[model samples]
Target: MERLAKGRHHLANRTSLLRMISAWESGARDASDPYRLLLCEAYGKSPDELGLGGGTEHVRSDIGLAYLGSLESATSALGELARFDEMKHSAVILGKYMPDALNAACLDWLFGESLADLRLSGSKVTSQDVAEVRTMTENLDRLDRFLGGEQCRLMALRYLRERVVPALKASKTQAVGRDLFSATAILCELVGWMAYDTSRHSRSGTSPRP
Candidate 1:
């Protein structure tokens, strides 16, 4: 509350708050905009650069683990800031990692850790895994309207095959398949961005209404 209060009260603090919170999930350059670009950048690094993945041993040694945990708390506190809308949660949440520059030095605590835990637990939640939740999602039309079905499909596909695939490919375990699929699963929120960016309502400044 006090931290958020400081952010609310002071402009510099607000910016600082934004930077600090997002840093856990993204890095300094990220935590900004044009999101997918950031995600793409983050994809290029080897585990040596990120120093994550492999096995339970890696998870234990990860320095970002604590930061990732704090990020979950910060995300909840900054929920409003993270949410551009239901579909555009990319601006506010871990959605910053995909389809973008992606080279930032951050991890979206909960999303990253949960995926890690699933890997450690031997669950099949890979980056490429298909999510049943999205299949049953009711708000997809807005996403389709924003990015369009073709673009959205392409966006989702590129998210998997281009970015996360290489990382998974380098993995020594079968978790690569799961990571490919799970990485795709992480797109649900961004898919919501599809509802916003691809829809008529999203035409605010980009494509005005006729």
Candidate 2:
């Protein structure tokens, strides 16, 4: 929820700072340690060169995988909850930036026929989808359409992990930057919690938190 200028740490350069700022737009998983570590590496610094220390690429990926696991946990938690108020309150808090995405997510999570259905319901594809289309980025206008909006950084992440890097890997280019896939794992979890929790709370007749 914090702005780039308002986030906890400040980098010495605009590029690194923009990477962090881009994390928010991309989604939490894309911002994972591996991704940030790679980003740091791109900047000619190890993760330790920055304050991240051992927040290496692998470590960040582990974190993201763990959060991806939590998505199911949240779903179970929501299904077992007796009140919508608690859930709704949680969603409202999380919707600070991606309100529409979070809102639709919450609604689908609670009211959907089942958890499996809920999982498949939304278009919360995120910027990772942009990764799939980046090869065509010679057209800047198309790039703008693909990576534009509040979730640009989120989508930008996919461009690295899912689309570009994979293609590069096919040609054996080898990825040298962040493990943005893991970051998306966390992003999905965060939005999942926000959506299910908020919708649950709202359905339970609980007033949203002040």
Candidate 3:
């Protein structure tokens, strides 16, 4: 109580503290964001590691609306996300369509498009391009294992915007196109995972509306 009073928390009074504790213990109320933050500070662990409500509860949103119809759309969405992250407006893109968008894109890659002849006048995509994308993705996966998915979020977006997406705009064989699109689908899932992590951490106050 004294620490809370000195720290300017709303639950600084002993009476309020007792009531809050009683509520939490009796399951009448779950801890709010502010209380969860204070508890995290007290425990010196992450919310998920501590099993806080932020980790246990699901965040609802319309992220499913972000459907990816082609490699072009995937690239554009990823570019937008990269720009948003740079502008510190990442929260804006984390909407309800995320899961659906990822699912659609993945399905497209897995069983949808056959990409028989991506005919272009300029230089055609070769095995080297596919290999490069695979290498970069593998590297990104390694980074995720070491640094956690959140750490790779911005870099993943940047890579998709600059490298993979641009490659999509270039002419490629049908086979090469298929490979590129499949890789792009995987990349979209990566971005979605990052978005999920971002949403988990930023979730404060009320749960997201469906």
Candidate 4:
């Protein structure tokens, strides 16, 4: 625990470390975004894998949510956002940082989980597939830059839900896996930025990009 506090958790004091541990174990304090991240990284586990879900506050939406833990969890959160976009929900949704979720994801990336070889037994994901995704993302980036972030949100969400997520679920080689993960990361960043923009626009009573 001491080592975790000083080295992994970066806690400043022994008393605070013991108190935090006790709180986390006893469920007295929900793990905030930062601490959750430290715990996840130190342990090489997901928020759910470490039985830490109930101990943290969940961001109801990703618009304002700044942190995420693992690719899997971040993907799941993106799925939720896609559903909302599909339903034509309001873009003014607000969110807070979800430490545990973001922490796990950060640790996963730091440990090269995102770069791991993918094992698959189905049709190969070709270089062409990767190129297509890259092109599409570039186009979306251009669109967002010219029109506005809001202009690209729906298109980004659709691409993610219809194309990216499906490809990720399928099997592919290490090369393809790296490309796909990279593409997904780009898409996620685009969507998150767009969402944040939309929220800002809504708050200021300004119109979104047409």
Candidate 5:
């Protein structure tokens, strides 16, 4: 598979590629994006034919309503939610709220076990990173106030998905992890508020996307 990937100009470390292949085979991870393309090329099959693309749509539509138990889970959930919003799928944009799901999520959040300290091997997160996220969130909040949620929601989702999610996955000290989590929570809350505003406007038949 590494040789095949290399043939397709996708250079990756042999050990890492082997591990990724193992994960994909065992269903521990989904083959995403470039890997999906590479695998399709190597196997001469479409992503749907390879069973790699069918489940994502369902998963994305179902994301963001569950109670995430840890920082890692929270990060993954937030990333998926942002991706779902960014896709602008009409079904998701106008989907009805599930009262039962909201109740269950609230219960789980209230009763869930405390998150363990994050200690992953990746880029280090710092106070500066947390501050940057907070600053961005504040700016986006101002925009939401001035221009409305429909105008600023996508940008907020994009930043959260592209920048904040990766930072949440990076290595950080306990203190920094807490700070980062707090900053991320603020951003997530802002995004949720924006989503709510957009939904309300949509239901009133007054929301117009430009």
Candidate 6:
């Protein structure tokens, strides 16, 4: 907390700051406004990176709207889209719908160069990982059918951001990688449909096509 108050003259008392920190950490209170900014600075991370949702610096309003050139870029774009949707709660008013951009994205997808092979050193991605994502997509589809996409879209986005996107960077055989990409594409399609069901048509158009 001292680190957060370094140059500030009107600092809260140490005891009060400790109490605030305790409350924030315990989920008894949100770290709002100036405190949130202070936490971000002290940690050298954006609020979103710290799991504090309201920071505009890290929230790209146009995320996932264009066709990226490589697997790495596509993976990063997917993470950004999922994070934005999760944080904004499918608020369409904050986004613009560009049919032209969507058209270009689709054209690029159909005729663009194939993504280069990824052979990074990380956890090994196997056929089982692909199956798990497919299974989760199926279960989420069932939930969407019953509960509506608005009710369940956040869950799907969270899984895509937290689980599947990271797995895309992991080490995998060529066959496993192909299968994994196919499974992830199906999941992305489901997420897009869920966004559409919630009336986030722009979001549906922007989901990663890989």
Best-first order by lDDT: 6, 5, 4, 3, 2, 1
> Can you tell me which runs of candidate 5 are displaced by over 4 Å?
1-55, 58-61, 114-119, 200-210
Better of 1 and 3 by lDDT: 3
TM-score of each: 0.22, 0.19, 0.49, 0.50, 0.64, 0.70
> Candidate 4 lDDT, tens digit per residue, 132-171?
8888888888898889855577787678777776676567
lDDT (CA) for every model shown? 0.33, 0.34, 0.55, 0.58, 0.68, 0.77
The C-alpha stretches of model 4 lying farther than 4 A from their native spots are 1-77, 88-94, 97-123, 200-210
Summed backbone clashes in each candidate are: 47, 26, 11, 9, 0, 0
Pairing residues by index, what is the TM-score of model 3? Answer: 0.49
Give lDDT for model 2. Answer: 0.34
* Candidate 5 residue pairs in backbone clash: none
lDDT of 6 at 60: 54
List model 1 lDDT by residue over 1-210, tens digit each. Answer: 233334333333556756654663553222222222233355675332442211212222212112333323322222222122222332222222232212222344324543232212233343333333244233344555554654653344344333333333343355454443343334434544553554422211111000
Taking the tens digit of each residue's C-alpha lDDT, what string does model 3 give over 43-81?
A: 787655665442232322322243344534444445544
Best by lDDT: 6
Kindly state the number of residue pairs that clash in model 4.
9
lDDT of 4: 0.58
Off by over 4 Å in 6: 1-61, 89-93, 114-119
lDDT tens readout by residue for model 6, 1-210 = 567567873557889989977876775544554677777887898766876654445455566777876777778778767765665633333677677887888788789885684547778988899999999999999999998957698788888988898898889888988898899899999998998888888888777778
Model 3: how far residue 206 lies from native, Å: 20
**RMSD, each candidate, Å?**
16.9, 19.4, 15.4, 17.2, 9.9, 8.2
Q: After superposition, how far is residue 192 of candidate 4 from its true place, in Å?
A: 1.7
Clash list (residue pairs), candidate 4: 33-99, 37-103, 68-101, 68-102, 69-101, 69-102, 69-104, 69-105, 70-105
Candidate 3 achieves a global lDDT of 0.55
